[model samples]
Target: MSELCHQAGDARGMEDLMVDYYVDRPFFDELVGLFHERTLAETRAALEGGVEWIFANCYYNSLSAGWSPAIFREVFVPHLRAQVELVHRYGARLDYYDDGKLDASMELIADCGVDVLETCTPPPVGDLDLRRAKARIGAQTTLKGYVDLLWVVKHGTPELVERTVAEAMEIAKPGGGFIIGSSDCFREGTPPENMHSYFQACLNYGVYD
Candidate 1:
């Protein structure tokens, strides 16, 4: 990878780097295998230290990385499946984090036996359809995060926060597989009143009965 970048010259753009290092590269499989091995080692160490959940942050979201369904199924899925198996063997849950355009890959991740899928970013900022996701993979995987932190949480009114939370609850809360949270961590300047409303709405609608 470094060699490719060096050959491409310092002024080469991100597109050049992406093509050289990721897309159709001869060393892709070898690099992926090495990363998988390192991740497994880290997961094992964390589990041995009594971690209850393994957070696997996959940087290969298809929207930006241009990964095809074939590449995802053939190359990535097996690595994810192995991680799930290893985590389960140690009695720990695996939380797969890919905070972008999950609609393309959500089912495949769930099918890998992952316990939780994080940051189900909704439309505009991302393309995840929470309703579709809930109906499809909710039974098998816990769906964490759908709230839009920037638009609805930070900038919108408290009423909007409640409404967003309520809407999410209506779709994903029924089957006991949803977790209401922001697209990412709540930003620094988010209004306190909205934060209160977000939690209050969760309490109001999150009740099972």
Candidate 2:
């Protein structure tokens, strides 16, 4: 990744590769501000590099602790909008990833022209009503995911998992846009039996026919 960054003659080439490194480091206020600045700078560089799609990740767990809508609008939204616009200017699409409650951020996300919004978490934290999200975002944006990962798989029985998957398919799969998967990253402690049950459910219930 460092080699790629060097080859491209800019930091943008290695932006994705830096994710792990950033994860390991501590987050300070100065660093947080720097993070946003670097994101905008790298996004512009990526657009200039002939990239076709830009994956934009919004706030993670921090939103749950009350990163209010006003704070996002005043501080973060403009930078995100700029990134989306820069990508669009280069004929690319933006996919914004936010697993937190997006009720506050939806308008800003839409305003940024996000082509795809991944509702990667389930209800309470995210829009469990995939249909409503689609309606709200309208036809211009594609809605993806709303599966209850922790509830259906980790705690539920195999039969329950199967039933949940069947229900999810009935609601989320009728249309052409949705994709079914874990609501968040599959955790290590998730039982193997539950994992097996989840995949079996997907296989048994995910078919169009």
In angstroms, how far off is 62's CA in candidate 1? 4.7
Total backbone clashes of candidate 1, pairs 3 or more residues apart or in separate chains = 0
Q: Lowest-scoring 10 consecutive residues by lDDT in candidate 2?
A: 1-10
Superposed by TM-score, candidate 2 places the C-alpha of residue 121 at a distance from the truth, in angstroms, of: 2.1
Against the unseen true structure, what C-alpha lDDT does each candidate score? 0.78, 0.62
Provide TM-scores for the models: 0.85, 0.70
Q: Report the C-alpha lDDT of model 1 over 1-209, residue by residue, as the tens digit.
A: 11112222233443553565456575555555665676778788989999998877774534435667676777678878998999999999988887777888889989999998889998788789999999899999999989899999999999999999899999998859888888888999999999999889989987776
TM-score of 2: 0.70
Model 1 segments more than 4 A misplaced? 1-17, 21-24
lDDT of 2 by residue, 1-209 (tens): 11121222133323432342346333323444465666767777887888888877554412443556775566456667776777788899987777767665676677778887775465755644655555666455766556666776776677777776777676666655555666677666777887888788788877666
Candidate closest to the true structure, highest TM-score:
1
Candidate 2 ranges with C-alpha deviation above 4 Å = 1-34, 60-62, 124-127, 203-209
